[model samples]
Target: MYVRHVAAAAAAFLGWALVLSGGPATTATAAASGESTTAAAATGRDPVRLVGAPVLYAHRGASAYAPENTLAAVDLAEDLGIDWVENDVQRTKDGELVVIHDDTLARTTDVETRYPDRKPWRVADFTAAEIAGLDAGSWFTPQFAGARVPTLRQYLDRVRFNQQKLLLEIKKPELYPGIEQDTLRVLEEAGWLGEQQVENRLVVQSFSVDCVRTVHSLRPDLITAFLGTPAAEDLALYAEFTDRINPWHTTITAEWVAAVHALRGVHGEPLEVDTWIVDDPAVARKVQAMGVDGIITNAPDVVREAVGGF
Candidate 1:
């Protein structure tokens, strides 16, 4: 199923690329930019490499244990001793960057009863203050009755306080204009970039090439990742912008990982290959053996244990 999705999405994007470029071989120079991997890529001087091969990343905190994206989830992930925790960031109506997975508040929040007038309950429709008032936890279970959505500052503080690294995703960035700059601004003000710890603890990633490029251009020193499978040319271009190319785990192939690893990145470093959302320990072991550099999942404990047993 995952391989099918990857193939379908790749084909669709290829078609879109051809349409935009008026020709497949002509429009995407990035796809056709190179013949082999750079020496920099082989050096492996990336944040992802520092943690070692098969690094474990907590997805939306320990989402399997607590409400996803809530402070409770982050706390649990940190407690589990995961190498890094990942979270999604979106802009509120008032321009504050808050943490949440979905563009709408209905599934995670009691927005239907809390604000019936605000039909559709989109995240961008409400101010940070308003979003704070919504119950972000109760929906998951009765144990967490009033978990509120955390602002980017609040989320980073927790990660920093715990001395854990982060894999921050700019969710649906196209929905919020200038969000790329705003995110970089927030991180800068929060001191995440202090002493240039980007290679040590921070990775800014997004599904949107534009957002990834935006962040890379703003902070050339920081590490970035692309969360999609771009064509060969686009993959080469991604190599020029990000330190990693994270793909869905279901369809990942050893050759695919090797292909990306063979490319050089913007800082002349190796672009690591990481896969996401794998929960099964057996499946985790398979991907690791396949040479995936990192594994992003909700069950960090499960994967960590699997890694230890090896």
Candidate 2:
């Protein structure tokens, strides 16, 4: 069934591509552009060679050094020589997309004190401007005072300007309706989508299978990763739609990795397997030996060193 759907989608894409190609010269140019984009997207920027070990992705932009989901955290990851940074995305009440991990602002901002009457004061209930008004950084450190929650465009621009790869987690799709559409819109508006070649540099991840499916439907070229706890049945389901499977590192084993690799997607491609929050050097080495494609961690510097030793 998955293979059939992929064939159908590919046929549709080919039809669209042909319709856009009116002349031979135009057709040739489009084909060339498509090839270039595919190559660029396939090559991720991480420095750790994946031949012997998994790539190191900075979880929440090196959350140990800076507030998670902040631009500062992402910048810190880049400066630390990490190749790829991971962050989360949530929608606002006004349909603006912002970078944040939690559904509510209580933990990261001073919202509870300022707006006492706002019940269920979730991030989805506030507009972008309302979210920006709250101090999002001081909770982590006094030095990071006045840090504001950034929009998806701002975060993408920063990542692109720095020439970095990203693992963008789409959070809480159920609470925020039309999140997939909003996310695609932000990527398109930032010139990250469309016929451009940078699609491979970005990986759209979600715990929700439906949301991941929605993204895959709209942009088949963009890599989609399904995040879930390690379970044979869950992994089997994810094998249908995702290019990669990210399971909690604690639950991952060699058998799990083998199972994920054996399961093919709708494209008949083997799904890449990765695990997260692997901060210990010994554990990192162990997981790398398990044959996972990447390891997401809060401590990229430590993982980089461990990978270098191998």
Candidate 3:
């Protein structure tokens, strides 16, 4: 969670910036008018209307309250009343896809203790069965000691059972060759490729431009997002294949959100911006006021309350 802590620190700094500029609520509310006026000229289309508070996505399933990418995390997010959950998917040596964040297993699981000899326990180095035998949740708390890493199939079944929406990230696709095709195969077999699921319940996202394009080409029906910001001039090309632009929260501003919203996606709907990894309420409200369409966070419950109060 070092990176999460760093993001939170950055959020605090941004919150401070909001205070110096004037309160986030008042300043952004006042800026909206000017932003709207220039929005069309900024991107060659009328501004996409800003919705209410941004939608909250449980980053790796309310990870602040549960072990990330575990079934427990998903269940906890559901318990928190968050319908949208974001998770990372990687492939094991046996070609089975699993829900985990890092290329290595040392941080989120008891891998080092389980296999002390396996120096750098990369996720792709172990077979799925080997990974399944390791405890994934004990690092978070003893209460979750036995929580095992979930296979993508198991993860999908659980999410479907809960009737939750998923922002499924294709984490580091380069490490796992042909993972895009492999992932589509899984989503198809699991019924996620169906019309309703594609339209409503799923979004496949990746930081890799090639991977995003590949997913778009393979399943044009499925909504897809690019995880990092492209150049302003590049947004049009991305909009041809991607539906949303999801950037690290620190990089977002009202102007950037407006720029993204001015373009139409492959589906003919205005492109959206969903900023990532913000866990602070002040920062949450700041981004909400910036007109972001979504906030992906480790503390979904807190953000829900924060944005609601704002």
Candidate 4:
């Protein structure tokens, strides 16, 4: 079933490429032009590998510089000239998709103080309006005091408005049952499910194998990534559905990367490897040297500077 979906994805990707005749704006150029950040897909290749250096996705939108998953974080990432931003998605009680990392609100927002009896403060326990009322950024710093937790709709528009690409992770899908469908609906509503966006500007991912598979089965056109490294023996199986295999930096090596790249993704192109959460310059250089395709970092400026040969 996964292999069969590739034919459909290929046709869609090729049609869009022929219509456009070239790739969308490059990340750096897109940053300046407010254009989509997806590169065009040629006949049999995947739309990836922008300009040689590993593409840098500001983890949770430059979390080191601003409150994570907040609009301010994405804005800070764009201000730093990083064109790719990664974010986490969860559902509120009202079924509205929202961008926030923790399942609960205490760590990132002042939910505990606002609703003192709401002990756990799980995001799903609150309505969209209630979640929006909490201050999501003040915990990081007072200057970001009023940054409300953005609904996924708001987050998508902000990224689109900024002309940046997204690596959107469907966080803890099991807890939200049917969230994969909800997410696709929201992405479609935001125009993110369009072929061009799927081919170039968007990638939906999850640490959950079932969630990742569900996304692919539902809409293979969207590029998808699995958040952790699967067993070497399982790489082929994962490639059938996921375009990228992203793992923590410490768990990979040149050989491992080669093994993954040796296989083809659902789009009939080699699977890519992008490692995560690497905040230190030295560690960023380490992963770059290991031949990983991209680095997810809190400081895109620091990592971009650390890894030479742009």
Candidate 1 stretches greater than 4 Å from native: 1-53, 232-234
TM-score of 1: 0.81
lDDT of each: 0.75, 0.72, 0.79, 0.78
What lDDT score goes with residue 184 in model 4? 93
lDDT: the better of candidates 2 and 3: 3
Question: Residue by residue across 1-310, what tens digits does model 1's lDDT show?
Answer: 0011122233223222221112222111111132122332233222212123367788998888678998877777665557588999999999999999999999999989999999899999999999999998888877778999999999999888888888899999999999989998899889898755586889889999899889988888888899976665567877877888899998777668767777777878767777898888668767766667778888775665554310
Worst 10 residues of 4 by lDDT: 1-10
CA error at residue 299 for candidate 3, angstroms? 0.6
Q: In candidate 3, what are the lDDT values of residues 141-178, reduced to their tens digit?
A: 77678899999999999999999999999999999989
TM-score of candidate 2 versus the correct structure, residues matched by position: 0.80
Cα-lDDT of candidate 4: 0.78
Clashes of 4: 2
Q: Which pairs of residues clash in candidate 3, taking residues 3 or more apart in a chain or in different chains?
A: none
Candidate 1 C-alpha error for residue 27, in Å: 51
Tens-digit lDDT track of model 4 for 1-310:
1111122233223222322114343343333343333431112122222234567889899787778999988987876667889999999998999999999999999998999998899999999999999999789877678999999999999999999989999999989999999999999999887777877788888999999999999997778999998888889999888888999998887678778878999888888888898877678766665667778988775566556311
TM-score of each: 0.81, 0.80, 0.83, 0.83
Candidate 4 deviates by what RMSD? Answer: 10.1
